[model samples]
Target: MIKIGVLIPEQYKLLSVAAILEVFEAANKFQFASELKETFDITLLTINNQVDSFFKTYKTDTINTEEKFELILIPSFTTNDIKNTIALNRAYIPWLIKQYNSAAEIATFCTGAFLLGATGLLDGKAATTHVDACAAFSAAFPSVQLKADKTVTQDGRLFTSGGATSTFHLLLYLLQIHCGKDLAIKTAKIFAIDMDRHNQSYFSSFQPLRHHNDEIVACAQEKIELNYQDISTIEEMIKDIPSSRRNIVRRFKQVIGITPIEYLQQTRIEAAKKLLEQTAQQMTEVIYNSGYNDPKAFRKIFRKTVGMTPSQYRDKFQAR
Candidate 1:
């Protein structure tokens, strides 16, 4: 039996915990029906080893820390403040590091990556979290490679999932790795989860980091967002700024986490998405309006950024 540890941090997102447990519970049922000898043994772990009281909405259970687990799952937290959340749960860091050292695979759901990253184990590894928190995550953990476009990322034994619903995808991935593809598919069908779903790019929006106190970079970002349709917007921005083009580009990248040209392209693609979803515009019109004159170029960039073609996006999300 594979022992799975579900870490129940204080003020955790109850739904994420419940959903994951349900997936495993359903998998157990399937295993029983199939007369499979192997099954998962799940345990609820807490920081204080005392889960005496419920968190108002959900009940919490305590587990013995003496037992070793093959996998440790950290569920998302209800708090938006990553630093505060991490600080509140500082007691778990040493335990988590010990678990990792003992060969336990760590998996984080949504913003739980912040807590996982806090352990210093994710350094030099590719991981992902919720889309909206990508900038903050990147800023906070510079050593970790943040793959915001991916719904799920796994480096070695470390695993992470994007956003709330993407937790199901990560669980399915874990199921496939542990129990095989047949069991994973059976579990996915039981949960009605789409097994083919992979990338989180389709639902992600272009959220540039503007919280940094860089007035010039902020101005450059504003200019790009306002006039992304203009092909020479980058040059115009460079000329309008007081610093040299190279310096401005460097500062923009340092502050905004993306280059000026890349920002411009993302801004344009975001605009194109809005048009495709909200307006009855043709593909050519979307290309031109998004600031790209060439259909091929626009389509290529759109696919690269959004993980789908213009028509596919429109068909999937066109306002009915």
Candidate 2:
């Protein structure tokens, strides 16, 4: 049997934990039907030797601080404040490192990558998280290559999935790797999950961070958001922001992880996307209204950022 340890960290999402258990339990039933024995020895490991009353049906054990498992699962947390969540779950770091050194594979779902990255184990490895959290993750772990567009990323034994439904894709991938493609296909059919999905870009909403204390950066961001449609250039929009263009650019990048120009482009793209989804406006009108005079440039950037053409995006996501 493959030993699988699912870490139940502080603030762990109940849905994430439930999904992990359900998938593995389904796989184990398949094994029992065929091989007359379960293929997995699954255990929920927690630092505090405690579990909520909701999970009384499943196996729960306090982490021994010393053990080896073939695979370890890190489920996403419920909170957006990742720094505090990681600190709350700090005791898992050394245990994770010890298990990895003992040759255990680690898989994280959505923002769970933030907790995994906290261990420094994800340093210099390709990983991803929730699309909404990708910017924050990049700033927090510069050494780790962030693939925001990918629904799932695998670097050696470290596996990560994007957000929400994207977690099913990674579970399917894990199933295919361990149990075989036949089982994976059957499981996907059972769950109504489209196993062919691979990119998360179209699911993302460009949420510009606004709570930072940098007044100058905030001013530049405000100018970019307010003038994205009317202005031809970011410099023109922020010319009256009371700082040198170079200084504004520096602080903007420092605070926002993207340059002022990039931020403007993102703001414009978001506007275009909203129009595509919610309005019946013509493509040309959408482009110009989104601050792009050139349809070709708009289409190019839209495809590059969204992983699909404007028409395709609208066809898929437009409101009925």
Candidate 3:
């Protein structure tokens, strides 16, 4: 059985908390138990037994540390909002770190990544969170490598995700890994979500980076993400680098296996994907906002890379 625990504290983000509940609800309603057996189990844990407005209370003795959960999920809320529970809330940091040290695969959604970060389990892992918290998270835990792209990231035993509904992607990914693709597809269909919507599952190897040297590549990657709207030409990119354009291009291709331009396009497309999933922006607005000045070119490239037009992609992920 795959034991899944949702560590809920006081004053959690409604959407982040809801995402986990909804995924399990979908799993139960979509017949995952009939097909997958007792493979997926969801348990809610808190610091105390008292009920809060954010979630219903479950009995404290219901969870056993020896039960061996395969996954522990933490949802996001303000760090200061956990309320003043000495046993339930305050015990979270130490208890979570202990849980992480066990055999279970640990994960978090949005700022929930902060809880994992506080535990120091992600000190040397690659993870992601909502973009707004990236800089603060980086500064707080300099050892963890944080990426802002896509919804989910897995580094060894740890998995972290970004955006609000990315938690759904995270749960679906676990379902696929533990149960199978067929079960995952079934649950996704029941939710009216597209199975093909961003197929980069957590366990898959990411595409190669474009720069050979870690420092240079990280710098260049950061620049691309930060200045996606302002970047225009290869020469402009080279101007930001201390090395010559020829050397940077050579190193980037050697390390990342793609040209700078290609990486930039991928970045913009990724940005567009997030916007389409999260907002109601028009196609033209998404194109321009993602740094594509020419809407026609954006459409062609988006189609070529994603195998769907921008509108088609948007329609696929937007709530049914």
Candidate 4:
């Protein structure tokens, strides 16, 4: 049985927590159908051994790294929580280290990367956090190699992400690895999320030096140019890029100043913008050809990133 543990702090992003749980639940359902049995044992863990009756924070009753855990997930916490817990806390840190030492895979969503950074386990390891927290993450733990364009990254046993919504990406990544690609696809559909809406693999090689590192960035850039109409997995990208996954993530973030996923999001948005500006294509067709299945989600991401709705962007561009 795969024992999955989630370390929760107060006021954690409910969506991320719920997403992880749902993915596992889906996996459990699949396993049950396949073998007529549950293949997982999931536990919600906390720091102290006290259950807060009001908020329903259950106490962590035990720690036995001897029992193998397939995955350990940590959701994002506040900045204050990151600082206070990273440097000073041994209460859960040691156990976390123990889990790392064990065969269990570890992953974080959003700012939860801070806790992994706290363990000093990420020294020179590829990881990511919510883009808004990038500066703070780099400043706080310079030893950690932070990637910019990724929604999630997997460096050996460690995994991480850059935002609240990226939690879905992280879970899907794990599902592909542990459960199967088909299940990941199904889960994405079940949730009405665009499977191709975001590309976590792009951040594998993003960099801060926009113009200087043309050699490496161009490789990824060319692939995007050639396959902008088609999307591939991270494994497929690695096969084409000739860089190890970790090295790609580390170097890409250094050159592009954004994670690969961010770049892809930007690229797709830019493409959508251009289509919106120059073509008479309907909104649904624009979104579909651009690789987004959800028009509402497309509008939301576009408006959030571009500062206007698709209609607004088209109107302004048309007027110009």
Candidate 5:
């Protein structure tokens, strides 16, 4: 049996924790119905051996402190204050690190990536969390390669999934790895979850990083947001700001996590998205309003950044 340890953190998203357990239980039920031996030896591992959700209390079997689990599952957190949440769960980090050192695979769902990253096992590894938390995650764990666009990321023994529902995708992926593709598909069908999702970009709102305390970069960001359509070049932006071009570029990257040009592109794309959703603008008009003259270039960037073409996005999200 594959020994799996589910870490129950205090004040976690109850649904996420429940969903994971239910999925595994369903998988086991299927195995039992087929007269097959049980495949998962599941244990609820926690710091105190008891956890309280927003709605109820749970007490379950815990892992022996010295025992090594084959797999450890970290559930999504309920709170937006991830810094506080991580600090509250700080005690789990050393335990997780020890498990990883003992050759255990670790998987995290949504903001659980924050906790997983806290273990330092995700350093130098590719991982992802909720789309909105990407900036904070990147800022917090600068060494971990945050795959902001990916819905699921697996780096050897470490795994992470984007946002709420994407947790099911990660679970399905793990099921496939441990059980089989057939069983994974069966489980997905049972749960009515799409098994083919791979990108979170389609659902991500392009909120630029603005909270970093760089006054010059903040001013430049405001300029970009206010005049993205009128503005044409980094040189023009530099002329408007007091900083040198290199300093602006360096500071912008440091604070914004993207180059000035990339930020401008994202801002323009966001504008274009609004126009596409709220107005019956022609593609040419949208492109021009988004500060781009080339239809080809606009389409390419739109598809790359939004995970769909402009027309497809319009069809999917246009105002009713």
Candidate 6:
């Protein structure tokens, strides 16, 4: 039997863990009423026997440091407090590293990449997380090649998926490699999964952090956000601020993980995305209303950022 251990850490997302259990259990029962019996031996390993009460009904065991598995799955955390969540579950880092060294394949769902990243196994490896958390993940693990646009990414035995529903894609990928394409397709069909999906950038909404105490950077951000429709550049926008342009740029990048100009572009792109999803206005109107003066540059930037043409994005995300 293929043994798989799903780690049940504190603050884990219930849906992530539940979906994983459901998939493997369903895999075991795929040939129900036959002499084939079950195939996968699924186990839940909890952190200090402290998993969420929601999983109490499931048979679980405390993490056995000496136990080994063919594969381990890390579930996404519930909160956006990724840093603290990583620290809270720091005990799993060494276990994960040891498991990886012992030939166990590791898979992470959405924000679970943050935990795996803390172990340094993801260093220099291609990985993806929740599209909205890509910036924070990149800042935390600069060595990891963050594929923010991908629905799923794999490097060596390490696998990661972007956002919520993308978890099933990774599960299907794992099944495709280990079991067979047919089983993968079977699971996908059971879940009604659209196997064609590969990009998550269009689902991303740029939300920059504003909790930093850098007043100069704050002022710069304020000017860019409030005056995004204005024809003023970053340099012109920051003229009224007390600090020089160089200092402001440095602090802005330090605090926000992006340059002021890039932040403005992200803001404008968010505005453009809302327009695309909410309005039937002409393309030129979207361009101008979102603070772009040129249609060519806007389309190019939109495609580069959102991973689709404006029309395609609208067609996919626009309300019926």
Best by lDDT: 2
Tens-place lDDT per residue, model 1, 60-112, is: 34543667779999999898777988998888888888888899999999999
Q: Please give, for residues 1-62, the per-residue lDDT of candidate 5 as tens digits.
A: 88898888876887888888889988999999999987888777777776555424333555
Return the number of clashes found in candidate 2.
0
Ranking by lDDT: 2, 6, 5, 1, 4, 3
Which has the greatest TM-score?
A: 2
Q: Give candidate 1 regions above 4 Å deviation.
A: 34-38, 49-64, 231-233
Scanning candidate 6 in windows of ten residues, the lowest lDDT window is 28-37
Superposition error at 229 for model 6 (Å): 1.8
Question: What's the TM-score of every candidate structure?
Answer: 0.89, 0.98, 0.58, 0.59, 0.91, 0.96
lDDT tens string, model 2, 166-235?
Answer: 8899998999999899989888887899999999999999998899999999988887888899876666
Cα lDDT tens digits, model 3, 1-320, are 56778876755676777778777767665565476455556777765545455555432322335555678888887553222322234567777777667777888887788777877889888998865556456766889987755578899888888756677788788778876787788877776665544432221212334334567766777787788888977777767678877877887775665678887887888788788778998888899999998988999988766656778877877665
lDDT, each prediction: 0.86, 0.90, 0.71, 0.71, 0.89, 0.89
Worst 10 residues of 5 by lDDT: 54-63
Between candidates 3 and 4, the one scoring higher on TM-score is: 4
Q: List candidate 5 stretches off by more than 4 Å.
A: 53-64
RMSD of each: 2.7, 1.1, 9.3, 13.0, 2.3, 1.5
Task: Write down the worst ten-residue block by lDDT for model 3.
Answer: 199-208
Count of clashes in candidate 6: 0
> Residue by residue across 41-146, what tens digits does model 6's lDDT show?
7778976766667767766776665878899999999988888999889988988999899999999999999999999999999999999999999999999999
Looking at model 2, report the run of 10 residues with the lowest lDDT sum.
58-67
Between prediction 2 and prediction 3, the one with superior lDDT is: 2
